[model samples]
Target: MNYDDRRASPRYPLRAFAELGSSDREWAAHVLDISYYGARIALLDEYNLCAGDPIRLRLEIPEMQVPEGMLPYLHLEGTLVHQQEHMLGIQYEPASELDAELLKQILANLNK
Candidate 1:
């Protein structure tokens, strides 16, 4: 099987504000879908950014599992790898142990 067939990912919609800089310049975007590894985003506005631009995207997720949670999504440093129209595909810059574990579980679930 190919890699895509071997790995399973979740597809969910998230409302978020994407910032280009540390300063609070934000843009509204929709989470097209997400795997534990990375995500595909559809931006509402047009942005002229190149590949390898380090960007931090705040993914807005609903808080229902815990009473007190800081943020729904983990902080990620993304490298722009692919782009098509308004959609962008990025790979996590440095995926941690937790991210790797979660991705493994997600892929296992998807294959099963």
Candidate 2:
């Protein structure tokens, strides 16, 4: 079966820089795409992350403008669900209402 067919939600193509953090370390990652429940990312460096490992992600959206000293980012917590070479798939945990709303807005903008 195709990967999209197995997903719980539709994925939107998104290209952005991000930071992926695990309990012991962090890596610079590139956001390939995202869905309400998960995201696909490519790490800039090598690391040994496996399926079911917990992780934190902070996506930096360049299109969104913020005040001085502030950064426009979306922070999410998830588990590693898939990995191949430098790329990995993440299944996000349930987010707060604010985060959910923000994600929805981002997805909507992507469609335009």
Candidate 3:
């Protein structure tokens, strides 16, 4: 509950539906928490993720407030940084300006 001291960016708890992997091989995951640089997700299926595997994430949180010109989609190209059981820690690549702004907006809304 106290991730404030360690993370570069504050982590926000979010229960959002997400999709991982490429178009041909996608899996359902629930985003448990998110930050500017990384996220923790729970895989719905039994597939185990390997570290350093290139993956793409597509998250949708319909209830969260979104900034103007920003869609509800949160997409990122990331790598599996760590894993434990059914959960995964993904470190995202640098985001586009639009995505960065959108994430900031969502965090602000969540904090409120």
* Best of the candidates, lDDT: 2
lDDT-superior candidate, 1 or 3: 3
**What is the C-alpha RMSD, rounded to one decimal, of candidate 3?**
3.0
**Reference-based TM-score, model 2:** 0.87
Per residue, candidate 3 scores C-alpha lDDT tens digits across 1-112 of: 5434566877789988989985357899999998888899999687756888888998885654766667778778889888888989888853577777777777787777
Candidate 3 residue runs with Cα over 4 Å from true position: 1-6, 22-24
Question: Who wins the TM-score comparison?
Answer: 2
Output the better candidate (2/3) by TM-score.
2
Could you tell me the C-alpha RMSD of candidate 1 in Å?
5.2
lDDT of each: 0.55, 0.84, 0.80
Q: What ranges in model 1 sit over 4 Å off?
A: 1-25, 65-70, 93-112
| Cα lDDT tens digits for candidate 2, 9-111 | 7888988999999999999999999988999999969897899999999888766633335437778899999898998999995346666666777888777
Model 3, TM vs. native: 0.83
- Clash counts per candidate, in order, are 0, 0, 0
Off by over 4 Å in 2: 65-71
lDDT tens digits, residue span 1-112, model 1: 7434543555444444443322234556676666665677877686776666666665544344212423344445666667778888766632356444544443354446
